[model samples]
Target chain A: MTSPEERLQAAQQVLASWAGDTQSPEPNRLDVGVAAQNLIAAIEALIGARWGYLSAITGLDLGVEAGQIEVLYHFCEGAAVLTLRVATPRASASVPSVCPLIPSASVFERELVEMMGIQVVGTPDNSRLFLADDWPDDVYPLRKDAVLERGVKEQGNE
Target chain B: MSEAVVQDKKRFVVPIGPQHPALKEPGHFEFTVDGEIVTGATVRLGYAHRGIEKAVESRNWTQSLYLLERICGICSHVHAMTYCLGVEKLAGAEVPPRAQAIRVLVAELERVHSHLLWLGVAAHEAGFDTLFMYSWRDRETVMDLLESFTGNRVNYSANILGGVKCDVTPDLASAILKGVDFLEERSRHYLNVVTTDEVFLQRTRGVGTMSKEVAERLGVVGPTARASGVARDIRIEAPYAAYADFPVQIVLAEAGDLEARFVVRIKELFESYRLIHEVIDKLPPGELQTRMPRKIKAGETISRVEAPRGEAFYFIKSNGSDNPERIKVRTPTLCNMGSVVATAVGHQLADMPMILAGIDPCFSCNDRTVAVRDAAGALVTWESLRQRRLAHQENK
Candidate 1:
């Protein structure tokens, strides 16, 4: 059996144009930094080659000091996990949706937008996923600066 | 026929739940039906959302275990077990082999109960009450064993940070064996019934059939994907904890219909039975708990477990604090919900319940958003409803 690194190497070769600054933080996992413009191209290469299935799109707040939000698109095949890390400015963070290529990615993309407040441009469904229907606009709970009071609607006297 | 009438086909929108009797949980579905055939379908979940993910952020490392376990009452053990494994991995705490074995034992036991519950619910969805009664009655056996072992029927808090809290005694081991023996026989009988029973077969076989390509493309997980012959069992693909020591076999069915899902889950019970017995016979000897630090090292890691529904993915990022920085839990039901929505299209409106139930969805586990009817009496997207709220606030 080929090693996880070798499989990731194959993915890298396919995504040679967009793949940059690859890092293996742990065994059986690979993380690659991809430019936002080429995010879809890199994911297309992985899915096209059947490198793996789109596992989860994890959105991270890099804290206020960093002023950036990191979105990790994890693709898993067997024990191997390949992550495409894309960092966007926290002020106006946005990433293109991979839903056009992978239909299942829509759920995670919607979640990414609603929970982390990062915009997934071109996502078919940009509606609230896990949040209550009455959750306020511009109040994303997962962001470091988000105040819980802003998101919750105050109850009126019946 | 009038020309204006032909253009306006009068497509009726059949709205089901946030509190429908057909569904046990609170999920609103709007199905656009042209006569009996459903043209389009949409689902709104979040009715059961408790913000458990955000709630976990406030609690300390150990306290979050109990909170996370309550995320899903059916597959509670695996939820906490997966969380502990991720936290432990970041903390670099080595759980004892025996603890790992016991954890797997509880996990497999939980799978048995969960799959049996799904069987009962699926049967009920098909209007087969007798089978539902029989399966739930049989499910008590596993539930009883779990209670005896963990002192709780639901939300078995069997796992702690470093290791499992409970140890399997000789009597408990024998009790588990007895339960497995009875379950194995009952599972075989149910399998025969599902595959051969005429009434049940009519409702299941050749109904809600999803091909392998669709299953892969939609990224359906667990038995739902397995029914489509997608070998995506995390336990088999990437064995963790005791699974590496006592591996599990993957169960697959090609038809990808309601029947295939039934068969896949029932067959998995047999596999679970085999694993339970194997683990008991070769139960490792070691301590029950390990010494874990109060504050974990600053790091991030991923943990995937083959939950009864499908693959439960967890991403835990700790920041050298008593509490975790962020814990992202992507339950299997979330991944499988899209498949249910996709499969609902092109099916008879009457068969919608069975098709929805085919994936064995747990709305409580999957709920993160809500849906409501618009003032115009038309189904509206959650976004539009939220926009109305925003507009009202601005005017005020």
Candidate 2:
């Protein structure tokens, strides 16, 4: 059986070949978007269903300085957790939803949509998860600029 | 009296509640009932949504620990442990061996409390108030033990960024052992009552049955999945904290019913006692916590810790700031809630409470509201006349 480090190395090697980038020992800081797609394909091909668990999906907003959105995919290979990072520019912050590949990704994507306001292209259920039905379309509380104090009207009120 | 009754009646929609006596939490569940048997059920959540994920963003890293701890009062320590693990991973901090051992001990203690609490709630749903009182009385022992160690019972914010905030002295360890001993003796009696009590058994056994395959596909975790024979305990599979050194056995069952889930959790209480004793015996000698840097470097780290409920996950993204760039938490209840819908499908209307409690549903931690949709896909709300009638009348 290959060690976690060995498996990670093999994954990076395949990704480096596919993306035509210099193979580095650390794949933690890899760029997001296209590079992420290549890495995802590499992992799916190498590990297959053995690493089928999409444990969680996390998104982070890097303000105007970087103007980027950081998305992390936490996957489990048996007991070991391997995280894949993908960074996207804030202006066109979009990433392919992995729910089609992993059904568990659906909830995580819903959370990401409500929290970070990032567009998950082709997600089947993009409905509001933790927000009120009457909540304004443009408001997302997790974003840096989202207003927290704007309360919704009581149920009985018109 | 000889009038012919109309047999072919149309199905009527009944909304359970955003606030119903059957459900402890505030979330609406609409069931399409044909007399007593339910044809279809749709759940609407988010009534208790306080925007926790959004609240975490505004707080600093240290302050978030307290905020996260409040995610669920029952599994408070678990939330703190997961959040601290995330920050520690991002900062590349290694906890001391003693700290790890204490963490495992406290975590297992919390598990005992959570399971006992669920058992009480399950008993209440079955209308077995005697069992509810007994389970809660036994649960007080664990809470007292926690309070002795961490200064509080519910939100024992014992976990810090690098390691635990409090240390277990010899006296505290002795106190914990005494509590464990008491719980062990009481648990045997509770187990007998849970398994052999006729009414309890009748209400739970074969009711809310979720097949192993459906449980897996729905991603159910903790005892709910274990009862269905999934064997997916995070503690046994991925041992973090002191669990890696002193492994705790994962209790499992194949029955896939409310009774099976109850048995699995009851057995886990004994396992937790054994683990606490093992940790106390092998308590390592080292510093409690490692010093974390003031600023975290630009990097990302994801960590998974076995919370009392199941798998509690945290992913942290740091941008060389005092505050985190992003922090995401995937709670165990979120995974278990999916199974509620699958298991409740064919169950009778009267059995809804037991089925709902079988998953040990924690909507506060899961944070998703219920929205009722009609057969034609039209959204329905309390303003609908059908909902008002159900609220006023007790009988169908």
Which model scores highest in lDDT?
1
lDDT of 1 by residue, B41-129 (tens): 77777788877777777789998998889888899988898899999999889999999999999999999999999899889888899
Scanning candidate 2 chain B in windows of ten residues, the lowest lDDT window is B1-10
- Complex DockQ, candidate 2: 0.28
Off by over 4 Å in 2: A1-3, A6-50, A64-71, A84-105, A119-124, A147-158, B1-11, B20-23, B368-396
Please, what is the whole-model Cα lDDT of each candidate in the order they appear? 0.86, 0.75
Give each prediction's root-mean-square deviation over alpha carbons.
7.7, 9.5
For each candidate in turn, the TM-score is 0.91, 0.83
Show model 1 residue runs off by greater than 4 Å.
A150-158, B1-10, B20-22, B368-396
Can you tell me the CAPRI class of model 1? acceptable
Superposed by TM-score, candidate 1 places the C-alpha of residue B380 at a distance from the truth, in angstroms, of 31
- Model 1, chain B: what is the TM-score? 0.90
Question: How far in Å is the alpha carbon of A105 misplaced in model 1?
Answer: 1.4
Model 1 chain B: ten consecutive residues of lowest lDDT: B1-10
